[model samples]
Target: MLPETVLRTDDVAPDIRFDVWREAMAATMSPMHISSPHSSDFWGHTRLLTLDDVLLWPVAMQASRYRRTAELVRKGDPELYHITLVLPGSGRLKVDHSGRRHLSTVNDLYILNSSQPCDVEVEENELAVAIGVEIPRNNFPPTAERAIGRMLGHRISGQDGFGAVLSPFLSHLVSRNSAHRPSDIPRLKRILLDLVTGLAARELDAEPSLCTETRRRNTFLLMRSYIQRNYHDPGLTPRTVAAAHFISPRQLHRLFEAEGITAAAYIRGRRLAEARRRLADPAQYTTSVQTIAQRCGYTSAAHFSRSFSAAYGMAPREYRELEHRQQLDTELRSLAPPATAGRDPIPA
Candidate 1:
């Protein structure tokens, strides 16, 4: 069964909303310390939405502190993980999760797993957006410890570089008018996981894990598979292919070099070969040359004809006609009566 929950707190008062959120969270998971600026009455709005087990929340906060201890916590243990993001104002964050500590500022993100106790304190009024992703610790692919814990708190600001592109993309997705379809959940999760893992590895200087020969080869194979699966799209190009693989143009070129071909030439040749096979099939007599070309990635029928003539010494239509005639000739010969030179079959 799929699980989805959405919470919007934009209009509700901060304290009242937090209280309701605390009770809901506590019931769903464990107990935790939830507070705001003691100096002033905090005023803000918040929204939380969960789609098929994934959660998204955007909150405008005046300032707050949230914590979960072991004593009164659910199941006699602390929460498993707390993932938070700061959208506005400046504050500090600290987590004591694994006998080690992680600390950051407002522009930063903090991911803390709650096998142990910890505290997060924000000092001033600010708006924040976050998603608390709770998954069993063992589910994550084991890598260097540096890549562990909540990840979005690192360098993804959704403002610059990869983060810049991703941040606004997510912000717009969570905006009031947007509606995410359930069918898109798989793709959404895949993209989100890729972005998170890539950013974490980059920030922690853990690229060696992803840059290993085996890993690179796996990526190469995956891209090759994707191309093979989508070779029929006429607009396929090096740039689009590279973007799909999350690599730069230069890197994509190098990948093709390692595989022994130029990207564009490879895709073009593969598509042409598919067209040629279709042309050779006697069963394709009713299929038009333009239909074959379109199915095999040629945008212009005339261009496909020219290219086919250059490559195979005949236009696609002519090739199919020739193939069909040859097949009929062969069938006629097979159906003809045995000549004197032919031996008669012996009775079994």
Candidate 2:
């Protein structure tokens, strides 16, 4: 599950709100000097989700100015880099290493190194909102340093190129309020890492340096994502997927082999999983089994029933009954009084 933290200026006393916010920012992120013209009436909020070694922060704040100085670099942790995506404001940023200044508008992204000195000023009239991803320096390829150095203080459009793919991903991750399953964290982390690596490699013209295995894994993930989005289309097949990705069917099968599953089997499994979920949902009870089957890409009810039974060891109707019974049992348990030690058990 993604661990989260939330901070707001309203939680502190009005007189010391800015100071509290500044201290919280330094502690949560890297040490930096933060100020605002309306410090006394400042309003800001930050929501952060931690996924393994990466930190996703979505922030909304009033006009503010911030700077990371050489002194702070010497005093703070200097092994992190921040990737920021502007959402609703315009700002000017300067990187000390390159001495270049850039104006960032909505959907523009830029990278900042914690070890380097930088200054950012957001206009007071427009609220500044952005999603910032904090990644460890070691998570990136060695060649990325040169690329990042060259790109620092420059605007990268999130509406085009690799940013088009990466921007929505980061945005979606931070937008979720529900906790993710613990088992899914590793896969999510790998996807994020690969996307960032690919972006950096593209910037450096160093795609060849990315290991072959990593590239294959990323391609497989891309295929899986495509399948998930388009699985309802009856035309989705291994051949179609391979063609979309510009790979041969044989090569696609080879990639799936590394995970000990065939491409066809994976697609079937995903469709079955979705069907099972719908069957177990109380709200979907009015929907017919045949309708559910077709909705999940099964051609006919008999085939769906056979596959469902083979995968779950129970027919769809039986599984739905079991799920309903389980839900009732949970509600009953919640309503019952707590058990007491040395006391007789409640009669059924």
Candidate 2: stretches off by over 4 Å: 1-10, 36-38, 41-54, 58-79, 85-110, 115-131, 147-191, 202-206, 328-348
Residue lDDT tens for model 1, 139-199: 3466723475535333344333334433444555566324566676676655544444555
Candidate 1's clash total is 12
Model 1 scores a C-alpha lDDT of 0.60
Candidate 2, RMSD to the unseen true structure = 5.7
Which ranges in model 1 have alpha carbons more than 4 Å from their true place?
1-18, 25-30, 37-44, 72-81, 89-103, 124-139, 144-146, 149-166, 176-179, 208-348
- Displacement of residue 99 (Cα, Å) in model 2 is 8.8
lDDT of 2 by residue, 1-348 (tens): 478898898888899888888887776668998988989878889987888888898998888888888898998775787888887554443333347777788888888888788887887666788998888888776765655656766778876546666787888788764757767778788888887776666666666777886677666766776777677777889999999878999999998898899989989999999999999898998899899989999887999999999999999988988998998899999999988889787899
lDDT of model 2 at position 268: 94
Query: How well does model 2 score by local distance difference test?
Result: 0.80
Candidates in order have lDDT scores of: 0.60, 0.80
